[model samples]
Target chain A: MNFEEGKKQFIQTWGKLGSEWGINRTMAQVHALLLIAPKPLSTEEIMEELSISRGNANMNIRDLLGWNLVHKELVPGDRKEYFVAEKDIWEIAKRISRERKRREIEPVKSVLHQLQEVEGDRSKDEVKAFTDMMNQLGGFVDKMDKSVDIMLSSDQSWFFGMLLKLIK
Target chain B: MNFEEGKKQFIQTWGKLGSEWGINRTMAQVHALLLIAPKPLSTEEIMEELSISRGNANMNIRDLLGWNLVHKELVPGDRKEYFVAEKDIWEIAKRISRERKRREIEPVKSVLHQLQEVEGDRSKDEVKAFTDMMNQLGGFVDKMDKSVDIMLSSDQSWFFGMLLKLIK
Candidate 1:
């Protein structure tokens, strides 16, 4: 692939994958472009390379930054800001896991917890049942989140090696 | 919560989460209902409970089955197929991880591999950059999936023990 072709393929595929995983398409594409760039890219550079509008590039770049997937940069001599993705794959994964947990899991847990507290004798069985099930699910999700934390915190080589063994 | 309130809250919250995660509202609500139900429920029952159109119910039910999140139950002497969610939270998580990996990671890997095969010096640099980044992301995802597999494959006691530690 030529530079243009490779960049196109990268943006398109990354955008598609992002939508599949619940992120918006442009946000993912912006992250992809930043991920592979040799240096922090300015917003104008991103707009030019992707052929996206300035507003679109600006908005999506902000979204990626909000997700902690990309970071802002200021060169010593540069007036405009540049952006870079979290380069270490493990760190990228860790930040994503943490953000998703906050956005998805915590809210679900809160709702489930509140639902568990409602009272009534005639409906007590159903309430008890709902709470018990929610508690169990919550606990399980909590465990999975812990596993992610532990995996992220551990030495990458050791964790990956152990994970590889477990998979087989 | 009373049965009506608790049930409504559960469905609404689950539906919201599902939409945020790319699944539709009714599909998530249906799954949420099934998640806590003590018994398998028929299609008509689901339609009635959810007040969804027959086509919508059928389609989303099929999707859930496809994701391995739900399954058919044939009650003795019953002509209609009933549905139930996989009750084990760990199992549910595992199936979700596997299905998501198959849907998202595998396809991206194929694209990455194809991009990696394009030939030319300058082209190769771009191709190499995208392919290498994607391959790294793919590898990390595969490893994370393995960790999920390990948790799913563990014996009941072992799994619960981990859950206990996590909850604390």
Candidate 2:
């Protein structure tokens, strides 16, 4: 494959993977484009490259910024804003983990905690089953929460190194 | 909250969480309904509880079975087929990890491998950057693949036990 062919394949694959993980396809494609770019790209450049509408590109770029996956860049003597992705894969992983924990895991944990307060007779099978399931779900989410925290706080080498050792 | 209210909240929350993670909202809702039930639920029961059409319920239930998250149960002497979710949280986690690894991660890795063969002059910056990015991404994904494999092969207590220790 040539450079252009390879780049296209990378972007398409990344976008598909992102959509499977709940991200919008166009947004992930934008990120993929930025990831392989040698330098920051202006909005006009991004629009031409991806063939996306300006509004669509703008919306996804804003969302990516909110997620801390992409950043705005101002070129010297240039009026247009440029965008770039954080290319360090480890840092990218950590940032995504952090965002997901905040957005998804933490909220679910809160709901699980609230469900624990459901009023009922303890001996009733219906109540007992509900409480038991909640407890189990709560415990699992807590473990996942802690795991993400550890990943966010620790360096890649130490974390993966230790994990690899344990696995073996 | 009363038992009925709590059940509603739990199902709603789980469904929302699932959608954020790329699972269909109705599918996750159906899984949620089955999760808290004290006994297996029939297709009719699932449709009534979720307010879904028969076709919709059947589709999601089929998907759940494909993902290995839910199973069909034959209640002895009953004409209708019943369904149940895997209630063990650890097992549920493992199954999801396994399915996702097969469905998503492995294919991405394969594409990364193929992209490595992109023909280009090593001295050219564009070619160099693309190759370098692919290598880095390939390495990171390989590590993740190994980690998921370890999680799948180990018992929950032993896996989480070691992971917790390592995290600290």
| lDDT digits (tens) for residues B1-168 of candidate 2 | 998999999999999999999999999999988888888999999999999999999999999999999999998899999999999999999999999999999999999999988998889877888898899999999999999988888887887777677655
What lDDT is reached at residue B139 by model 2? 90
Could you give me the TM-score of model 1 versus the true structure?
Answer: 0.86
Give the alpha-carbon lDDT of every model: 0.78, 0.91
Instruction: Name the runs in model 2 displaced over 4 angstroms.
Output: B166-168
The residue-by-residue lDDT of candidate 2 on A90-167, one tens digit each, is 999998999999988998999999998899998987788889899999988888888888889888888789778865
Off by over 4 Å in 1: A1-3, A122-128, B76-78, B116-135, B148-152, B156-168
Q: Which candidate is the best by TM-score?
A: 2
Per-prediction CA RMSD (Å): 3.1, 1.2
CAPRI tier for the interface of model 1: medium
In model 1, the number of clashes is 1
